[model samples]
Target: MERAGIDGFVYQGPVRVSPIGTHALYEGQARFIQLQFLSFALEDAPNLAGWRQKGMLDGEYGEAFDAFLEITGAVPSEIDDPAVALFMLILDIAINPSRGFPIQIESFENFLIDVDAGIRFVRLCQAARDEKQVLSLITEYSFTQYAEAADILTSSCGYDHPLAVIEHIVEWQEHSPVAKLMEEKRGFTYDLSNIVVRVMSSHFLAFCDDKLSRPEFFCWPGAWMTGARASQDITNLFLKHLSLFTDKADDDGIFPRAIPGVSEENAVKTLTAFYANVINYDLVRQWILSDGPFNYEFGWLTSKHSKEDMTNSTKQAFQHAFGASPDSFTYTWAEVK
Candidate 1:
């Protein structure tokens, strides 16, 4: 069992029977008894305590606690582990309130036990609780919210779904002070500015590349225009270069422009100059690969499009601007003129 990565324990003992049980029975009977137990030990078990402690200190555990309160609508004192408390709360929400017996909850608990997740399932539950919007979406949109909740809990812990993260970030921004300020100043009453900022800051090249490669994915060309209206130097830089990767507007040379902002002529010239400098200095690839908050935005694009296609489009964009693919381009930051 040790060779097979199984831990086991054995027990042996002698058995004794009552002599009065049968008149013909032997006075004493000798019997061999054996038992074996098997289980797997946790790796780095001590670290979990420290991790939980740190989470508590850093407010992650508190956030989970608040989410637990929201989901279960219960006071914090009633629950031992916030994660398990949340899980039970979700079960209550999923099950019919009129039912007297919680058979479904019992069966689900048994299922967790069978999968050996019973001991540490709280961690997974905590992750699901962190993404409150996803939970709410599942509740409203899914007929089987219980199963969906389980799947979300498991996936949140195991996978890095970039798009979902982006959505969460964008949604959070929509309700933020920045978004409200932009709305009041620009007369745009939506999250378009935040989405633009998020995309530019996090995934600009990948986003444009995806839009260029798959026109269908370019459902919101106007969003890019809205980004242009941000009037920031970095945003202008993105729009100028992005045009080289996208289709030129119609005969009037008119591109989608946001209302009450920089004039069309200035926008074009600024973007043109920005594009020129980037291409001239071989900065196209660097901009895409630079270490920044938005560097991995392309990862989010892959949720809806093929990674290969996104890569190819990015390579193509670089080639269009720099006359060479990213891999073949020899310019390094130190070597740049």
Candidate 2:
């Protein structure tokens, strides 16, 4: 496939591990599970089956499923087990799929099921949230204890909260000890890689639920970069990254290590260079930077420079902000675009 020019990080297989926990790794795993559950649950539903059959699950569906497997190494049976139902609840609320798979909860009975299971899962989510707020789990809490809670939440019937439950969870996380620790620690001690994994997982969930769009993936790369501004700087970094490559090149050929961070001049230079290498970058750039579905994926980040609409200039601007090079590497345009 690489030789054939079909490489662009396409989704692969199933979960290899269990999908429940308070650790950052678990957070990533849960998000993957939720994304897959959302995609498959909706795709498999009786009502939405027809629409899904038309190909809604064809493009990124595998990505979500593969994401689940990558994060949580559970087999297909484990993923589908009734004991793992809480995974469904979190996906339904946080990664609610409306288009390919819509939520049809109209009765108290279904709501009860969700509420019962979600409560526990939400608690685990709360614990994890607190740890994130504090910016350190290994340093502060017992990983075993946190994992135990996560297991209970992931496998039991406590994940039944509506969207409102998320608010409470957030509130709890905010007031929790972990939050204080994170605030106090600030930039002194932070595991950015873990943070990136968590954010990517969350964003991936949002994308699966149709809340987030394709372009938002760019911000994730930036979030993974070093520096405080990486957190605040959101200039549609993904587009610039994508545009940097020519459609005629290999996947790994894109994204050079020497690429600088996003900046004004660098952004324009990168955009011009991408256009020079791959004309299709223009089209993909538009789809990514457009003003559609970003908030659905990026929840809180949209408020700051985080939440933003698409723009024709976004490709250049993003590259400028990141200081990327256009000729760094190459990949076929159709693979990722």
Candidate 3:
């Protein structure tokens, strides 16, 4: 009869908590409930124990189930008994580190029913389209809520992971009405190069100087390039857009206009350093200084430049423009690629 902590419930007798009630529980409590239910189900349901003995609940699947719970906050108590039982089976075939679990027809119908219920609950609780509300939704486990959070971040905050989330949503809900609507509205084709370009352009215009707080602009391109399902279109688009910043050079040397909270010199240097790190020095030099268009038709540039070369180039660029690197200027990019 443990207290449910933030959910303000105590397990009484042999009665199980409803999925709706489980949803109200805090993460740790929810995890406890899931484990408790799983253990009970395993003892009562011989099929589950048989499946577990058959390597269906191996360490890998167990770890993935843990992660799934972490991300989606799903509790066994929240899903139908049949669905929960089926999920253990699906976990054996699903749950890869890189590619994620593919939707298996055997369990997905019940999974979707649970997902829809979570979505309705989240939507009902949503107060507004502000950052707080959006973040809360994103932190939820339901597919629709995750997608909606990504969309809100993209449209309102100019955050860039929405594309990845949308891709996942499309895969999971390929035949759903919502998925169809998203495909029609967002053109959820595998080709995301054009969308990346447009979104990056808008993000640069909107939040270039605010990169300290929202470094997603810098990291996102690399993320897309690394994870892009298509070809080199993403890489090409990134180089092309980065070239635009190079084109912003003035007598002051690459002074991006209208960026706030920093001098033009610092902004240029930070951005240049970021580009050097992501694209390599040879490509940066070619795209920034060369008069020709970047030949992204090919993959990474053939010209070999060491990390030292890129670092020195960045320092030289800063020194030439600002006489010295700014002592306190600090900007970082996520290691997405």
Candidate 4:
């Protein structure tokens, strides 16, 4: 605002999640908060950075940046493997994208499995819990389902819709009211408090729903020894602990398990539903190839694995999607043109 020769506005911290929740619980919360942050940034850059400086945005750097590094409890420098790259992509989508196509959390969960990086995921979850920031603990099974929580925040929380709200700020920036005021008078008071409130509310509501509501137990200290192989494994362990601790489901049965005497038909039905989703991804795939702006990059990121694993795992993913044995696979990441 100084560039516009105006001043006065409020701001809030990145906020935090507690570290005491169950492993499954805190991870869900962390994912949700990350989504809210990403959605807000993608929706509007200028409102936060000011219209005059819309051309640039600051990276999380300096003392605040170092503090974030320290706060994470796991050093950013420690993530130096293929799994780290994938984690970075996931975070990139969560924190930096303009607007990633809506996707399921399991897509992320599965990718962690594909890369053999379940432990890192659990460790992050544990860290959040240790910080006492996770406000909810619900375990959402799919990304689509998790997005439902986002919808609740947009509807119930007083903040503007993440994308639409940001868009409005950008629209206003075209003829920034804050700028016009300064031109008309020697000094003007800009009530950018609205912007600050909206952003804070979005962050607050996301943390509440994802972290505070349904806390879970994470084996942070023993995550390595436990050796859980996938997100699902970590998730199951948390659920099992809950079952043992609570002795039967919560009153509402939010986390339901099968009845022993029931026929296996229900299990088959569940598998069928999953298969339908995999099949439907073909439509999303077609959309990317034909209309997606980042088609080439998407293809490469989705297809490439590490050089250590010569058979690109993404190609194997395609084969598995088609019911073909994933024993062998290969694909080139040549330029899309």
Q: Please write out the lDDT profile of model 3 over residues 1-337, one tens digit for every residue.
A: 1343322233443432223322332332233334433444443533434545656445434443344344444444332232242222222111111122322234322333223323322322231223444323322123354345445433442222433432443344346643443342222121222333433433443232232222232222222233222237544444433432433222323333333344555544444444434343344565456554332321221234554564456556545544754333344445767
lDDT of 4: 0.31
Q: Which whole-number lDDT from 0 to 100 does residue 283 have in model 2?
A: 35
Clashes of each: 1, 55, 2, 27
lDDT of each: 0.35, 0.33, 0.35, 0.31
lDDT (Cα, 0-100) at 231 in candidate 1:
32
Best by lDDT: 3
Determine the backbone clash count of candidate 4. 27
Q: Which has the higher lDDT value, candidate number 2 or candidate number 4?
A: 2
Q: Positional deviation of 124 in candidate 2, in angstroms?
A: 23
Report the Cα lDDT for candidate 2.
0.33
What lDDT tens digits, residue by residue, belong to model 1 across residues 146-199? 345544654665522223332334443355663554333233222323333432
Worst 10 residues of 3 by lDDT: 89-98
Better of 2 and 3 by TM-score: 3
Score residue 50 of candidate 1 by CA lDDT. Answer: 47
Model 3 misplacement above 4 A: 1-61, 64-274, 277-303, 320-323, 326-337
